[model samples]
Target chain A: MLTSATILSALLGGLLIGSAAGLLLLLSGRIAGVSGMAAAALRIADKGPPWSQAAAFTIGLPIGAAVVLAIVGRPEVTITSSVPLLVAGGLLVGFGTRLGNGCTSGHGVCGLARLSPRSLAATAAFMGAGIATVFVARHILGAG
Target chain B: MRHALPGLVVGTLFGAGLALSGMTNPARVLGFLDIGGRWDPTLAFVLAAALVPSALAYLLVRRMERPVMAEEFCIPQNRTVEARLLAGGALFGIGWGLVGLCPGPALAGLAFGVWQSWAFVAAMVAGMWLQRLYADLRDHRPVHFTG
Candidate 1:
């Protein structure tokens, strides 16, 4: 089912992500880590340009998606999990990202680009965990 | 002031990228994660494509003395491969596998106005707050040792 169109779109999308991250770093000298930025925006103790910048970036996420919807049409999303499950998952993601100090964007995309050993280790750990969880959820638990 | 515009622009582009890459779709993301099942390698392509530009960007950064808009680069300084990193990454991976939604894609998906996205964001924020509280409590706890 992996068609050429799918490959092209994925590549194009990734290029955009990389460009955006690069732009942020080149212009503002900041890592394009979504969780870190979101947390910084919410943290009351943090002040000034960094806070405002983070808030702006957080606000822009939805706006960009809106633009994509207008231009390219909305992507189909179906959540089969119950609300409770969803909440639990969300909580873990939020907590883990903060505790780990990065996520896919920070560690996977940007960190890998820089060839940082820590990021490499984090990426491998998360990928392994993710794969194992998916196997258990889909195969063993039958909770697709 | 200057930082705001660039931040917004970068965020917008990043969100757009996520949407275009099919990351906004939970099913597709789950498919990518499901290695034993009907695994999808589209995300791998995305990662590879993203690396090209980002790698070049780092090279560009190496040439610059400072960011055009900031006084100094605010890169992460910690290089330790601590237990926290591994544990937190594992936890995050499990959550991501369960929901197929990470922070960036979750935030970008908010444009759909789905209750799931809203709920996830709310829960994520609360979790972050809770972690901060725990960290604070740990810092303030009195050390007791038995001689």
Candidate 2:
């Protein structure tokens, strides 16, 4: 259903996301990438603002969702994959984001905004890979 | 504490955006990915909306001497495209397609208290730890001596 409300929600949501990233950079000198921040939250050895700040940001992710839920009610979320599939996907995401140095937010959002060639390449690769995976899973494998 | 306060605010906003944009919904995300099917272009709009302000933010950052809260910006310095980048991206994409959930949404979904989100988060953390371990081992590998 491609309604005006959907479009408005997406646009507003995107603005909020961009504003958060922008503010993070302007205020804290950090890229608002979830994977990196989450990893930093687990870094026991690293000290200083980076560690505590990362931990705080990570904690806030869920809180932000909670706030949205409080206002707009719970979102409709469907989990179709089995436990094994979910676990495998999660592991890959975690490992790949770390190895690749960023995920959608870091590479797709901030990196593209910066006009970094590496980010462009990474984004292309991931998007291409995502399209191929979907094709295989849905068309070829008949999973979807 | 001051530094962390900013992080918390940013994170909250980010999460709220994810939920509001419907990124937290796996079905919606899959709709976006399903170009061959009934595709949903909502995610693209979200991306565009996000890029506009973020691009502007970078422009603003260029004029500033330093962040308001930090001494210096900790931006990524690496420029070269390496094998790791391509491989990792490919792997990440595959995972994203399978589940339609990325790190941000996965964490945000935790607020719903669903078992699947919890499982995914736990596995994700394990995967990160595994990567660190692998990197450590590779870096510390003993050099071989040729006869």
Candidate 3:
């Protein structure tokens, strides 16, 4: 249940994330919102995204993680959620992120940073719902 | 190549950050959401810390004539908090609470070789496709994603 809050590591990691986001914004003039990128991945000409940068950024996420896994250690990813649950969750996440027009990265991080009201509203709604869902699952449903 | 290079570098840095911050760990994310239980404040720190640089970057955007690589900073102009936004956010939260993996972490989690990661990502993509199809039907046109 309760674990030690690694504040320093989170802070450092967040700074790196923020820097990366900032770099993207400055260099490529794009918000580093993963959901948006993934949702529109196959829609080659429908949208106005620069496909080259989007493709490279999408490809690099796993590469960076693999490097960390090799050099340091794998991030503790002991997921016990059933395949059914995972699928349901993924479907909801995918549909919802697209519907809302952003996810944690887009709304929670990038949106908040830019002081966008819509992002703020979306983030608040998600955070509130996320907390409520966890409570229901853990306390009521007896699920993880 | 220049365009691709910057994106690759940025994505790498972002992936490392997600891993190093323990965002890649579903447990850590769930723990943060475990407010009535054993709550963790690590996510808060990460969100707060992340805002600093991006906030500055946005401010800088105001002053710059144009971005280095792009013709213009490609930010969408959706200001209102519409019903779709709230409903979609709530739905996403439910899924996130169930799995503790969002898009960013899910993509990055591919490196961890977890079955859950694969299942989640595949289903997520399918869901996105479903949503796009639904949107197209609603508008009677293939909607251009401005996300």
Candidate 4:
């Protein structure tokens, strides 16, 4: 379903994210660190990300999609997995975020862009695990 | 104060775009990684989506004399190659290759209500926890980390 058109659509998507991060810095004196926001969302009471912030962040995701769909149309998806595996995966990521003190966005996008040491470490861990998982799944377990 | 709101708004828009573009969907991501099989080409799009804005941002920031938060532009200080760094990188690569989602895409995926994205995220957190334990045990030894 993807072609050069899809690539253009993606560039647009990345621009949206980079633009948001820039705007956030310009307006709020804050970095659009997903890990920090997410951690706050999970750990803090109402103190977590402002309801508006969370809502906006969540809503923006699909809105970005709407924009793409308007331009590039749609893409097909293929997956074969059990619900149990899915649930297990979500749980593991949540745990990793807590341990790492940030998610990829916090580190990879916002943090690394800012030249943060902590972010670099966090991103490295995130990618390392990702690669290892792929190797084990594909080569060892032979699972997709 | 108001400027900050733009980031939040932009973030939402970005996330939504990712979903609409199929970047947030693990299947699309996995397909891209499946070079050995069908070899879907969506990942290329995702990287492109990320690269352009980032490059522009770097350019813009360079033009600015100062950032909003600090007097000087942020720059990386650490330049080390150590064991812990290698270990962490390895872990991240494995996780990414297996699931086709990383931190940026994972958060975006969370909004789409994809079960697999959620799972990848959960496991990612666990890996961080294990790292922390090792760090504490090592008493903050020279742990290598990269961006």
Best DockQ among the predictions, by candidate number: 3
Residue-wise C-alpha lDDT for candidate 2, range A3-111, written one tens digit per residue? 9989999999899899999999999888888888888888811222487788888888889999999999988788888999889989988888888887899898899
Please give, for residues B1-147, the per-residue lDDT of candidate 3 as tens digits: 868888899889888888878899888898889899888788898889999999999999999988888788888777998999999999999999999999998998998988789999999988788788788889999655634
- Which CAPRI level is candidate 4? acceptable
TM-score-superior candidate, 2 or 3: 2
True contacts kept of 2: 0.76
lDDT: worst 10-residue window of model 2 chain B: B138-147
List candidate 1 segments past 4 Å from native: A44-49, B141-147
Distance from true position, residue A51, model 3, in Å? 1.4
Q: After superposition, how far is residue B82 of candidate 1 from its true place, in Å?
A: 0.1
Worst 10 residues of 3 chain B by lDDT: B138-147
Candidate 1: residue B111 lDDT (0-100): 97
Candidate 2: stretches off by over 4 Å: A44-49, B141-147
Candidate 1 lDDT tens digits, A61-106: 8888888899999877777767887898898888888778789999
Q: What is each candidate's DockQ, to 2 decimals?
A: 0.59, 0.58, 0.66, 0.29
True contacts kept of each: 0.76, 0.76, 0.80, 0.38
Question: Candidates' TM-scores?
Answer: 0.95, 0.95, 0.94, 0.66
Tens digit of per-residue lDDT, candidate 4, span A1-144: 656766776666666666666665544445465644544433321233454554455445545555555555554434454555554554455445544445555556666666666667766676556645655676678887
